[model samples]
Target: MQKKLLFLCLFLFVEVITAQQDILSEQAEISVLTIGPGALLNDSFGHNAFRVKDPVKGIDLAFNYGVYDFETPNFYLKFAQGKLNYLIGLNYYEDFFEAYISQNRSIKEQVLNLSQIEKQKLFDYLLNNIKPENRRYLYDFFYDNCATKIKDVTNIALNNSIQFNDPRDFKPQTFRELIHSNLNRNSWGCFGIDLALGSVIDKKATPEEHMFLPKYIYRFFEVATIKNSNKPLIKKSNVLYEKIDAPVPSQFLTSPLFIFGILGGFILFITYTDFKKQKQSVWLDITLFSLTGIIGILILLLWFATDHKGTHQNYNLLWACALNILVIGQLLKQKTSTWFIKYLKFLVILLCLLTLHWIIGVQVFAIGLIPFLIALFIRYLFLIKYYSNRH
Candidate 1:
């Protein structure tokens, strides 16, 4: 009796699952039948050799059921069948580029609210253990799953000796010639897609399976350097600083102006205060003010979230620098007998040196990392001097 009951439950479960799958299949079919041909022209029409359907005229290019439709110009309007068909295409295409082997670890941690420093620490640790050869193996494994099949299908037209495809003509040839051909293709996206997809796929296939599409060809070409042994080590490119655009120049002035104004006002207030009558606990006052100012600025920056460009309202390093200045100012306000001024003056000079390092394209984390290291060394020297003198 127990065996019969278990069998009955299993039968019901199978029925439910089958029903769900049927519903999904039906939905997919309906979507492909509905969205017209306009979407095809927008996305895949010029890129692939496949047929694209027309919505209004009912003229089918490749498939009868699935088609693209445009609800508005420029904006991609959602269509059911169009998306369903596209998913099928993507599933097939993902087998070609196969780059996303691991779920992007950075993005996953971001959802958990991990700080940048924490992320960097984790990434650095992971990177150290993952040797260059292992990285190549991982990439090769991904290619085996995706690119090998694509290259096999596409390379039928090409000569067997070809390692890379010609951008103008999908002929197999040397990597240098392939790079030159791709660079000449103008669009980065075109190069990116072609290189990623082409690298993995097989070298020999019929024309229908292998011919390189014009769209997204440039994307694959530009990113070829990424795949090569010579990866770009520099994070910031010289091209970024070439143009003096809006908000950048404005932001530069804004930070300094606000800093100077408050500083000047504080100086005047101190001058006006009663001369010799006050018993000043200068060190204590300075420490308290600096602590309070730091806390206040941190709170403000956290709350405000608006930065120079206004493209994104986030508290980046610039906000931190501004806050640091305020804290330093507060520290300077106290008439302490200690060498706080000298310490701060040295820090300022160090910061200037670091800024110069960054401007000249130094391979350091922050703008003034080099200078910060120098300051630490100087501090160590001072510590040794103080101890030696006391002894």
Candidate 2:
């Protein structure tokens, strides 16, 4: 009798362990966590990740797709060429929350309204994605970054059953405007973005395309539904952490507009002095041409030589003409070629065309360039008059 009782006890223990494993799928919960933007330029767009929890199975993990291995070969070069590979990272949910909390960023979670099978499917998909070979993927700012990865993976798990309905407070916006919303126009980061990215982002982004931003992901997911049942996709929503209110110190002096305005003023002052003296300042012309020419070269490389889709079909070339570099020789000569005057005339026309482009919405130039553009226009006019009189 004692032996038989011992056998029964062992059998029950084994059964309990098996039941716990089985209950993981039934009791599991999956959620999408959206983190608010941070103070740094890199984190300005915020982040998104998937959270899977199963207390019965002792599984609580967050899967993030924003992980980039800096140790990879030619990391900086690949990054500049837009060939950087981002990888999926898995971490304990507690650690993930703590990291963002330390940064003082807000965290919101949307518990998905999915069946047990669907939850298991999503969990399995994430696990598979984190595998060594499957983890790395090409990252695109607009279409396939961290935020859009979550949306895509979730849709895949649901077998395209998710219907992302438009949010009640939705507004039509261009990709560039969406980006600008997260950035202060006067900031250097904003200036660099406006300088590098081209007119491709100026077009209106569709409602679904807005999910490229994490905040928009949270908003649209709130209204999304399952195609099969027409039921809401989010079972519950929770704010895991609320960012503390902190006063950001104003950086007015270092802003793009202020600095550019000073430079523009100096250029105009030089031109005015040159006009009064009736003598061209060769050094000033050299500096202007060299800078614009270098910028034009870089823009051309980014457009044609790199994989950055947003840099294609750039129209900033009108003002930062590559021909400026080729014409530097003529500027240095005592008697320039007859074509030099024609080139100056052509540059003036290009500047005028740039203004037309801005007015007609062909492209939106940087606000910081306003002062510089005005300065360039006046200088070009002065140059045209100067050369014509000299001839």
Candidate 3:
């Protein structure tokens, strides 16, 4: 008995020690994820380079932030004239140079041989893609380079000049550090020849021509190629845009199509349908509204939440059209209330705003889902009460 008790005590003590050791080790090794300087620049410009928690080759496991998302990158510098000049290099360099060449191919070939060839190839590639018009800026980017002198640029510290920092990360971080690091890493350690030139040239051309020529040329080279940025997204988006030939909407147009279309149909249904005569059961009224509201809002919210920038799926439109038809059909025989109508009208306006934001190249996720949250809470509350009574 004594021996057994002693062994049992020893085992319990061992277990306690093991547990304590584990707790201590865990506390000691806990990784507080500080946003690394590397991650800041990559993620800010829509690139993802998260550390692997258990990296197979370099370190232990690292967190994986999937694919880098890069758009046009530019280095903004103050010119000799004190006006801000943005050098859009890499992706925009070829882009702007090409656009000018295509317009004056005969002249450009003579004036800028390398630029003309690059532009011709780019134009051919763009015209063959999904959206010829969206990529028009690409043409302008090409033009800008052809006009820009190759040696008038100088790099200014990002602090004194904050004209073109990603608005997303404008709120205080080591932006200057990131720029320095990126420039050094990408062989852009010295300011480019064109960037130097941009600082001196203050042409009296229209904003489009002036901006386009310099902005895209600088963006193309610096943003697209330097630092080995998010080429896949750019390639995919560019390819997708090239295939579709939609003209750029005016700045005033802001909403997504499905939001407005569905809301418009809902409003018309409420306006024209006579619900009193049909005597739609309270359950039916709630059911129709709840179902439509939840589904519609979910679709929009999901699109806002996860959909990538510069891509729109027409499935949302198709769903809206179908839902509108059904709602209209149902309302033809039933009547809706004035209060209910007003609520729906308000919903429509919000939905229109949502669409507009979407059309303007704003990320949906960045826009909070407060409206959707409220709609969901109200809907689920009604559903729970209605079901509870039936049961």
Task: Return the TM-score for each candidate structure.
Answer: 0.22, 0.94, 0.21
Worst ten-residue run, lDDT, model 2?
Answer: 6-15
lDDT of 1: 0.28
Best by TM-score: 2
Specify the poorest-scoring 10-residue window by lDDT in model 1: 104-113
For model 1 the TM-score comes to 0.22
Q: Candidate 3 at residue 73, lDDT? A: 35
Ranking by TM-score: 2, 1, 3
Q: After superposition, how far is residue 209 of candidate 2 from its true place, in Å?
A: 0.5
Estimate, for each residue in 1-391, the C-alpha lDDT of model 1 and write its tens digit. 6544643553454345345532221111110111111112233222221211123323222111112222223323222111211211111112211221222111000011112332233223222222222221111211121223223322221222223323454455332233233332323332332222221122233332222323212222222221233332111111111212223133323333344345445443442341223333345335433543464454344334322111122212221233443544433442332454444454446445545533553312222222323333343234334323433
Superposed on all Cα atoms, model 1 deviates from the true structure by an RMSD in Å of: 21.0
Please list the C-alpha lDDT of all candidates, in the order they appear. 0.28, 0.88, 0.28
Query: lDDT tens digits, residues 1-391, model 2?
Result: 6544643553454345445544445778999999999999999999999998888877777889999877789999999899999988777788789999999999999999998878878876776676667879998999999999999999988999999999997898999899999999889998999889898988999999999999999999999999979999999999999999998899988898898899899999999999999999989899999999989999999999999999987888888998899889887888777788889999989999989988988888889999998998899888888888888
lDDT of 2 at 251: 93
Q: After superposition, how far is residue 86 of candidate 3 from its true place, in Å?
A: 30
Q: Which regions in candidate 3 have their CA more than 4 angstroms from the true location?
A: 1-218, 222-369
